[model samples]
Target: MTEFQILVVAAAFIVAGIAKGAIGIGLPPIAVGIMTLAVPLDDALAIMAIPTLTTNVWQAIYGRGLLRLFRRFWTLALTATIALVVVAATLGKLGSAQASAWLGVMLVVYSTIALLAWRPRVSRQTERWMNPLMGIASGAVAGITGIAAVPFLPYMQSLDINKDDLVQALGILFIFLIGALTFALFRQGAFDTANTIGGLAAIVPTSIGVWLGQKSRDALSPEMFRRVFLIGLLGLGLHMARGLL
Candidate 1:
C-alpha cells in the first residue's frame, strides 16, 4: 500500500472507533465505507479483520453475560456463522462492484430502519423458526458485503431482550461471524502483506478513537449523533448504490 492509502485506512479506523465508542456500533460500516474511497472493498475488509475480532471479543465478554446470551442465541449464531463461510466459499461469484452495491443496499436498509426507529416484534413462538431464518439471511448478507449489522441487528432488536444483553449477544455472534469472515478471506486468498499490515496498523487509531468517543459521550447526545450518523450512512449508501445503477 502507498503511504497515502495507509493514512486513509488509519483515519477511517479512528473515526469508526469514535462512533463505536459513542454508540456501541458503527465501526465496520464506517471504516469500510471510508476506506473504499481509497482502497478496494476486498482490501478494506481484509484490513478490518483484526480490529473487528478484537473489539467484538472485548465487548462480548465485558458484559459478563456471554454464557447466557450464547445459550439463548446459539442457534442464530451457529447458523449465521456457518452461512458466512458457505456463502464466502463462492467468493468467486461476486465481482467487487457487485459487493459494493450490496453493501450500499445494506447500508440504506439499516440506516432507514434506524432513522425511523423501526423495529419488528417477535413472540417467543415465532422465534423458534425466525431465529434460524434470520441467521441464514444475515450470514449470506455479511458474506457478500462484509458488513454484519443489517438483518441480524434488526432481528435481534425485535426479540424481547434487554439493552445490555443485546450488546453482549452481538459480541458472541460477531465472534463467530468475524472469525468466519477472516477464515473465509484466507481460504479465498484475499490476505496480503500490505493488507495484514493495514489491519495491524488500524488497532492503535481505533483504540484512541474509542477512548475519545467514550469521553465525549457525557457532553454529546447519543440521539443526535445517531441521527447524524444515519444521515451520513444514507448518503454514503447512495453513493455506493450507483454501482447498482
Candidate 2:
C-alpha cells in the first residue's frame, strides 16, 4: 500500500475507536465508510473487523465487573450470534454493496424506531424473555449486515442495565460477531496481502480518531452527545446508501 492508503486506514481506526469509546457503538459503520473511500468495500470491511474485535475485546475484559454479566448472558448471546454468522457466511458472497445498502436501510429504520420512543420500558413479567429474544434478533442482524448493535441497543436501554454492564455486553457481542465474521472471511479467502497490510496500516489513524473522539466526549454535554451521534448515524447511513446507488 502507498503511504496515503496507510494514512487513510489509520484515520478510520482512530474514528472507530473514539466512537466505541464515546457511544459504545458506531465503530463499524464509521470506520468501514471511511476505509471504503480509500479501498474496495470488501477490503474496507476486512480492515475494520480486526480493530473492531481488538478494541471491543479490551473493553469487555478490562471494563469493571463484566465477568459476572458475561457468565449470565454468554450462552444465549453467543449461540445466537454464532448462528447468525453461519447464515451470513452462506450469503456474504452476494456482494458487499448489497450488504451495505441493506445495512443502511436497517440502520435508518432502527435509529428511527429508537428516536421515536427511544426509551424502552419493559414490564417485570416480560423482562426475563427480553434478552434471549433480542439476542436472536441481534445475531440475525449481525449475520446479515455485520452490524448487530441495533437490535441489542433497545433491549439494553429498556433494561437500563448499568452503564458499565451495557458497555461490557456490547464489547462481548462485538468481539464474538467480529470473530465469527473473520473466520468466515478467511474461509472465503477474503484476506490478501494488500488488504491485510492495508488493514494494519489503517489502525494508526483509526487510533488517532478514537483519541480525538474521546477528547470531544469529555467536552460534550449529554444532549450534545446524542445530537452528534444522531448526525453521525445519518451521515453514515447516507454513505452506505451511496454504495447502492
Error of 1 at 100 (Å): 1.2
Q: What's the number of clashes in each of the models?
A: 0, 12
Each candidate: RMSD to true structure? 1.4, 2.7
Give model 1's clash tally: 0
Please give the RMSD of candidate 2 to the true structure. Answer: 2.7
Tens digits of per-residue lDDT for model 2, 6-123: 7777777776677755666678876766665666666777777777776778878976667777776676576666667777777774136777677776667665665576786876
Q: What is the TM-score of each candidate against the true structure?
A: 0.96, 0.85
Q: For candidate 2, give the lDDT of residue 10.
A: 75
Instruction: Highest lDDT: give the candidate number.
Output: 1
Residue lDDT tens for model 1, 1-245: 88888889988998889888888888988899889888988888999989988899999999878888887888998899898888888764322789988898889989899999998899878988888898899989898898888888888888988899988888888889888888888887779998898898889999998897888777889788778877988898989988988
